[model samples]
Target: MRFKIIFPTGYQVADILNDNIDINVVLENGDVFFGTLFTISNLDYLLAISQEPFFYASDLLIVKDLSKKNIRAAIESLVSGSIELAFTKIRSTWSNESGSDSFDTIIDMC
Candidate 1:
């Protein structure tokens, strides 16, 4: 099943997903971070740990239609360590912006 993850006003694409929940983050700028969901909060917070660093409460996207399949896929990806591989394949396919790279970067990174 397909699920739509929505971001709050100030939330970034990288902020979503926890280290315990197997998930792949697909950024608008084509940057993918693979990890598991370590914590999920009702206040639109998700804490995840990846190979690089630990994600905090402020770094998460709110998923509107959280579905079982989506969650399952995320878990599977995390367990298999395929999140990075999947991201590499999808990142390049993401369209690039023409405007201010810094602004775009900031927006996407948020």
Candidate 2:
């Protein structure tokens, strides 16, 4: 099933999923950490971390929602700072069948 993501800017998309997803946290020094998704409540997701909190997915950009098939691919692209590529890959794997076709076509063609 597909989930909707409501961004603070009022942007909404139906491609977001509630299951395992990937996110990148970019810090002040430009360092990035890849986290496995845990849950998305309201506008935040609880990510799986190895440190004290044991997990964290706060202050996320909700960048991209991925499916099992493309999660790894998306994370790899995100780590390299390839936002476009990551989203592109994710849209291809997570797009809803009853939703808009624009995204579907783009993913298909890509």
lDDT against the true structure, per candidate, is 0.36, 0.35
Off by over 4 Å in 1: 1-19, 40-110
Report the C-alpha lDDT of model 1 over 31-52, residue by residue, as the tens digit.
Answer: 4444333334433232232443
Itemize residue pairs with steric clashes in candidate 2. 47-57, 49-55
Per-residue lDDT over 1-110 for candidate 2, one digit per residue giving the tens place of the 0 to 100 score: 11222122222334445444444333222233434443254233333333355443443333345443344444445545744432322223332336533322222210
Off by over 4 Å in 2: 1-16, 20-64, 82-110
Worst 10 contiguous positions by lDDT, candidate 1: 1-10
